[model samples]
Every structure is written in C-alpha cells, then in structure tokens.
Target: MTLTQRQARMLADMTTPTPTQHAIQVRGLTKSFKDVEVLRGVDLDVPPGSIYALLGSNGAGKTTTIRILATLLRPDGGTAVVNGHDVTTQAHDVRASISLTGQFAAVDEILTGRENLTLVARLRHLPNPGAIADDMLARFSLTDAGNRRAGTYSGGMRRRLDIAMSLVGNPPIVFLDEPTTGLDPQARLEVWAAVRELAARGTTVLLTTQHLDEAEQLADRIAILHEGRILVDGTLAELKQLLPAATVEYVEKQPTLEDVFLTLVGAPTGAPTPTPAKETR
Candidate 1:
C-alpha cells in the first residue's frame, strides 16, 4: 500500500479504542519556509508504547518535522495523524492528547515546581490537581525540590520539573526535542530512565536529538534526516547494515598515530584509519 493509504488506515485503526496499536502516522509531509523546503515528503510511523528517535544534524529539518507533529506548525503539503486525530484538521484534539518538551525547558521561573505541575494539571482539567501534582513530583524524583522556585533550580532539576509538568495530564503521546541537550551524564541517564519507564507503561514517544548514542540506546526505531529529507528510516540494526562495514583496532604503542590523526582531523573513532609505516633499516 502507498504511504498515504497506510497513514490513513493507521489513523482509522487508532480511533477504534483498541488497546495496543500505532500512536502516530505521517505520510508525504512537506513543509517549506519562504521558498526553502524543510520537509521533503517525509513519512513515518510510530508504534504505541515505543520510542521513535528522529536523528539528524543541525539544519536537517528535525525540529521542523517535530513542530509539525506537535501541531505547533502546519505542513504545506501532506497529512499527519496523532493518536487518532489529524494534526491539521483536528488540531485541538491532537494538542489535547500530546505533550511537548522543546530543546529548552519551558517552565515558569517564578513558580515553584509543585506549582508548575498543579498549573498544568488544572489546565488539563484533571480532577484533584494537587494530588496529580504530587504524583508527578514523585515520578520525576522532584518531590524534595517541589517547593523551590523554578528560577532557583539547577539546570537538570529544571529539566526534570519541565518534563514532570508535561506529564501532569497523563498524555499518551509525548514529543521530546533534545530533552537532554544541556544535562550532565548523570542527569541524562536519569532522563533516559524516565523515558523508558514511560514507554514501558504504554506511552508513545517521538524524540529529536543530534546525540546518536542517545538514539541508539533508547530508540526502538530511528530515522536519519539529511538536508530536509529522510535519508534512511529503520531499526538501528537495519540502518547500521546500510552503512559500510566498521572495524576496531588495537595497538601496543601509546599515543598511536591513529589517535593523533583523529585529534587533528576531528573524526570519530569508528572511521577507517590509514596504515601506519614500520621502522626503516
């Protein structure tokens, strides 16, 4: 079947109230800004309860694609369906079902963490907002700092609070745009753990990040975007197979020539190294 047809079918299926199924579908999605095309007929599918990572370099349209899916931006062509609702046609419904955390944490600095969660819960019309706020605080390990002003929180702490606020409504679909960009290693791991817990509990996630390792570690499937187009889309194993074979090397010499070459050329360790010369007589 064509990608458009598949997306339509996926949308129809999601509306049926079935327990487990696809949570997002996109096909032939095209977007342009002032004659500069950002999304060139992109197609994607995200299964329910899975983490789907959109991996790309800077200016590759990853953020543009994500904004469209989040219903914050509209595509010039094609369609997208999220959680049984069309992003363009049923924009309000789509917004109601999803939460987004952009590259920067969006939180009210003057408000306390607990207050932020309560505000979001109330906005979502959840009953017993205070109770829901408490639950979110506990889930994100922010209970101890919940009473502190967001402005006083550390970067990692603020990020956790932002994510916790997003979960106030118990959204079934979440979009995290470089959610760990500024986090330290420990904080990044904490965020990853939270993401895993969400997926395990049946929440579908769509994340965009330049961190390939993060995508490799957490994503069930990944799509590489290059120059506003999807260069490849598949599981990590499938994508790895598409690339040239990689090799690992070990040497007895300290501060080897390969390491020096990499330092000067600024290439990753996985890239092939040139042969080194042996001592001459």
Candidate 2:
C-alpha cells in the first residue's frame, strides 16, 4: 500500500533520530569533593531524542554526574557537553539548554501548583507566565487543583508540577534524578509516560534510577554506574547476553510470588499504564 506524503513524513520523523547531534557527550569526566573522590573517570554519550538511563546504587556518583551535566557543579577534571555547549567553559550556555529535576520535588509550599509553575516561567522570562502555568496545569491533570497551594498537593501532583516547571524554558535535554522515588506505582507510570512524550517530541532525557524495571520500560540505552565509574553500557539485550546463560529451560510456566503479588494488586504485566492524555501545551 502506498502512503501519502504527509503519512510518509510522519513515519520518517518518528523513526529517524536527529542525526549528527548528541544531547550529552562526556569523556573522562571526573569530580571530587574534599579528600574523598566521587567521580574518578566517567564517560557517556546520549544521542538526541532518546532516553539514556544511568543505573547506580547510593554514593555511586549518579547525582554528581547529573549535576555536572546540568552545569550545577563544576567538574574537577575532564570535559562534557550538553546541547554542544561545554559544561566547563560554556556552563551558562549548557545550563540554558538543559533542565534538572532532582530527587525531591522543587516546589514552593505556600504557592499554588499554578503559581509554582508560574514562578518558574517568570524566572525564565518566558512570555505569558500565567498562560504557561495554566498550560502546564492542564497537561499534568492539575487544572482542577491548580488554585490550591503546592503544599496541599499529593506527592504525584507535586512531582508532575516539578517536571512541568522544568519544561518552562523548553530545554532540549532534561536530567531526571530518581523522578519516581516515593511515588505510588501508578504515579510512577504517569511520569514514565510524560518522559516518553518528551522523547517523542525530540527532547533528550538523561535519567538516573535504581529501579531496574523502570530502566527496562523507558530507556533506549542504559549504563550501570558503580564507584563513580560505568560498569556496563549497552542495550538490555546486550547486557543479558553478558549474563550467564540459563541452564534450566522451562517447558511449563510457574507463577512466582511476585506474579501472585502483582495479580493481587491488579498490576499489569509490562503493559502500558494509562497516563494523562491531555496534549502538552
């Protein structure tokens, strides 16, 4: 069947990543605090319009790496670039092209959800801060509660609003450090969908997470960081290949405790969880 020009263009856009452009590129990136070393030497390459997850345990320098990439912390050694702007020399330019969502939601407690986003918009000098705030509220399913103070918002709503505020400047790269922490499973899925929508719209996401399933769900590529260094980097399949082959081939399926728990809780088996269908404004 022949497709029309519009359909062809849509397909091309969906399938093709922005070539010759990398949202984040790092080489021998190093950082240290006091007498202790945090990041010995780190390297990463995140292409434009893809989700690259950094998986690590605590004190693995994941946050340190993200901070450096977002231009929040200067590295002790090496170089990194975000949106082609050097994190070392062009820190301001790199900051301009990126947004950072840290482990905790950064919202003003006394301000309404709308106000919180509005404040961010104003700070960024975005045109029509009120309109942008309302748009973010609607996009995150918070229009009904936008008038209420952020302190009154649920954890999920606050998290959503935090992410919405990060998008006020329409940055090309976003750094999400444990975005789903402390959320109910459903809320986690919502944020996951939002992250996907960002990538689909040509935004590059660099996420740090401890949740293995999350990495499987949202990341196109993943790197495991340990002791401030990347232990492995590859697609999920490639990582699996590196693991020892399973000797026991199960001809019959057996439900495990996790399956039973999920069944009891009504969790879907790797299905796409429903998310806010509102168009991003």
Candidate 3:
C-alpha cells in the first residue's frame, strides 16, 4: 500500500475498539540534568493498542522521555497521563497500568526462565503464579528451555523470556526501550512478531528506537526527536514527506563511487547509515 494509505488506515484504527482510549498523553514535558536541558516542551498522544514509535538520534532525549513516561524518572516540567492516571498525581495507578522493558534483559542470570517468570507473577500478585508462569512459557515458545538457567539461554531466548516476564500483570500499556539491540536478523523478526501480536491483543505500545526501518514497519504513527524536541510527529508517510519524495536509482555500468566508498570504508557514503537494530518493544 502507499504511505498515504497506510497513514489513513492508522488514523481510522485510532477510532476503533482496539485503542478504546488514549493510552498515553503528554504535554509540554521538559527535563533537565544539572545545567543541560534534555527535553524541551515535548508533547505526545498515543492511542490505546497502537504502536507509537519515538525515533531519535543519540542524545536526543528518547530514552529520557521514555523514562519519564514509565515513571522511572521524574520530569522537571509538564504532565503525563497513562491510562487516565497522571504520572505525578497518581503514580501507583499509572504503574499498575504499564509495564516497561528496558534496553537490557532484566531477568536474573541464575534463575531458570520459568523461575524468572514466576518471580514476576508473584510480584504482580497474580492469583496463580505457577499457572501464569506456565502459560507464559508456552506462549513465548520457551517451554523446552523453561527449566534452563537464563544465563545459559541464547541472547534471543533470554530477550523473549524477559519480555514474557513483563507481561505477568498484563498491563494495558507497555514501554519498550530498544528491545532488539544485538540479535541476528531472524531473532529481530521474531521480536517484531511478538510485538505485533501484543498490539493485536489490545496492548498499547510505546517504542523508542534508532532504526528507521523498524519504525516504518511497526509504528502506526512516528515521532522524530532532535535536540531534545520533537521535529516531526505523524504517520510514516507524513514524516517521509518532510524529506524528498522516494527515489529510484539504476546503474547500468559498474559499481558507483558511493558503492566503492561503502565497500572500502564499510559505511555508506551520503546515504543515511543503517541504525543498529536494537530490540525496544
């Protein structure tokens, strides 16, 4: 489908039952550390059950914004509402409504995958922690390795287990901060599939990442952050329109100078370098 069509579909989806309400709402959010201002009057509105992508270059305050929304760090200014609960005024309610998966897997190395999930279930006060653990183990396809210590699992397996643990309470909103950083292409796809499944099941997702293609693939709406401010916020096509129209180049002869440069330096010339894939949902 065309980018315009994709955006139209997203806007239409926002009014549906999937995202029944606004999962996250922010206004004039600003934060500073010492003398440096990291966020400058940031604002965002994420519909429930939709994947919202927060894209930015390094040092652009993407992580800082996610931290504030997740209630991990307090913002210096502005107010945020998650699931109708204000972050500052109703922190407990906000916490109860959201789950966060940070850049690194937070699972315990010594604990088996099942043990880790059981721990989260217990923390969430689930009625049957054992049952919840068993369900997640099968849902994430970790049943075979469920008894193995997390430290022994492959990187992808560990990441999946970490995310499964986060769902113990089944919070309506989830914040994923670079969730697929070091995995191979196949593993990355698996993570993406899992994220999509969650959204399909009516989970709202806020994702922060540097990977433009990932944003294009998953984000119903995309926000670009630059210098601690949102440079653009809209559907993928809207953001792409901020640049030139799509281009197609055909070379009939030999590899071009740009290709030679990329071959020698192992980096693209002039073209935007591909961002390292980091799992954050």
Candidate 4:
C-alpha cells in the first residue's frame, strides 16, 4: 500500500472506545480468501491490561485474526467481540477501541517525527495537536530527534515512532502484527521495552510474533496458533509443564552468541551468562 493509504488507516483508528470488562473475546473465528481457509476455529480470551501473544509461523492466520478484530476485514464464520462490541455487527465501535501497527512501520519519509504525530492528532480532531505530538515524542524517547525526518531514523527509532503514533488517542487495546519484524536485536529490545511500558499503563496489547524468544519476553499469556487452530493457550510456565520433567544430568552451560553480542555491543542483557571466552583466552 502507498504511504498515504497507510497513514489514513492509522488515523482512522484514533476514535475513543467505550469501557469494557474484557479486552477481547473470540470463539470459532474463521476466515477464507477464496478457496484457501486461513482460520478454521480459533478461540481466545484476552484479559484487560495484559500482554497476550499469538505465536504462529508464517501463513498461520495471526494477521488474519488481528484484521478481523480490528474491523479491517470480515470473518467468514464465528464471532469476535473487542471491547464489548461484536466485530461484525459493531465494526465502528470495535474500530473506536483499538489501534494497529502492521509488520512494517508506516511512517512518511518526508515528514519529521513530530509532524507525523501532530498530523494524526489533527486528523482525529484532537484538542492540542502540538502537545500530543510532543508528549508522544518524549514518551517514546524520540524527543531529541522529533524534528528530524523519519527517513533518517534507525529501524528501532522508526518502529517506536510508529507505535507512538498509534497511541495518540489512548485506545484501550492495541494490535501489533509482528511489530518487531526485520528489526535488529538491539532494535527489537527497544521495541520490547516500549511494549512493556504500554502494558504497565493499563493498555491491553495483542502481539503477534513468530519469534519464540519475543513471545517469552513480552507476553503474559501465549496462545500457539497453527494451521488456523489454537494448539494451546497458557502462561509460559503452564505450557512448559505440559512437557515431562527433564532427567537429572550434569552439563556445562555456554554463553550463547546473543549474550556475547549484547555484551560486546554494550546493549542491555536480561540475565548474565558465563563468559568463558575471557578465561580461555
């Protein structure tokens, strides 16, 4: 899609949603594009103000499910209620309650970061466009680069700005369709921090990612989607309990490449891993 089209769609998500007890509820949701069935029977229950990850491989209907909930596309069968409104019958109400960030950042190359934000605020007919833009820029740690054109931003910075733009109106729930796709490790970490902050502020996040580590890092609850079906849904520990306990064994653990890279680059590390390289060398 062209840049204008993408911006228009993002602006359309700025409507305010009514209060609801549950963030999202779906049952037997199905969709098909011509002969191919994308979603067979999907059931989900997302609690308020939590991060829910939909883990699936490519062509696993993650995006299709998100689109249906966001009211961008119609489902062929079953029901989806987002923020207390049925996705089909109450499409406008559903749209009012959520925002979406697609696989790629949909920012205008020519516009400055601040301009891009203020534009969305103005489109939504908000009260203070400048203040809203400034607040988002600061919230996403883009205050220093707010005046710079978005084309010059790094991958991580662009994604942060994209997410900030999606939050201008404070929609109750956000749909992130592979928000970290194509980002470098550092960039991905930056986006992860931003997502965590969103959940901390009582906003519900429905994240779709193929990266297992990403899901483990961000999601409070995870649902594995495969072949248009939900194989399992639970917390990480609950899912791990499904497997038999490991037999006792003594084995040396090694620092993974990620650890070495993060340490060498001075990026943040969640946990410390042994650095045998220093002693061996």
lDDT by residue (72-158, candidate 3, tens digit) is 899899999999999988889989899999898899999999999999888877799989999999888899999999999877788
Q: Single out the weakest 10-residue window by summed lDDT for candidate 3.
A: 268-277
**Model 4, which residues run further than 4 Å from truth?**
1-20, 268-281
Query: Which one wins on lDDT?
Result: 4
RMSD of 3: 8.9
lDDT of 4 at 281: 21
Instruction: Encode model 1's per-residue lDDT on 1-281: one tens digit a residue.
Output: 33456445543443333345569888889999998988888878788889999999999998998899888898999989999999999999999899999999899999999999899888878899999988988887788888989999877778878888887778999999999998865556667877887888889999999998899989998888888877666778766655447875553545565456555655422233444445433
Off by over 4 Å in 1: 1-21, 244-281
Instruction: Write candidate 2's Cα lDDT for 145-219 as tens digits.
Output: 999999988787788889999988789899999999999775676688778878888889999999999999999
Q: State residue 53's C-alpha deviation in candidate 3, in Å.
A: 0.7
Give residue 268's lDDT in candidate 2 (0 to 100): 30
Model 2's alpha-carbon lDDT is: 0.82
TM-score to true structure, per model: 0.80, 0.82, 0.81, 0.88
As a TM-score, model 2 comes out at 0.82
Residue 210's lDDT within candidate 1 is: 96
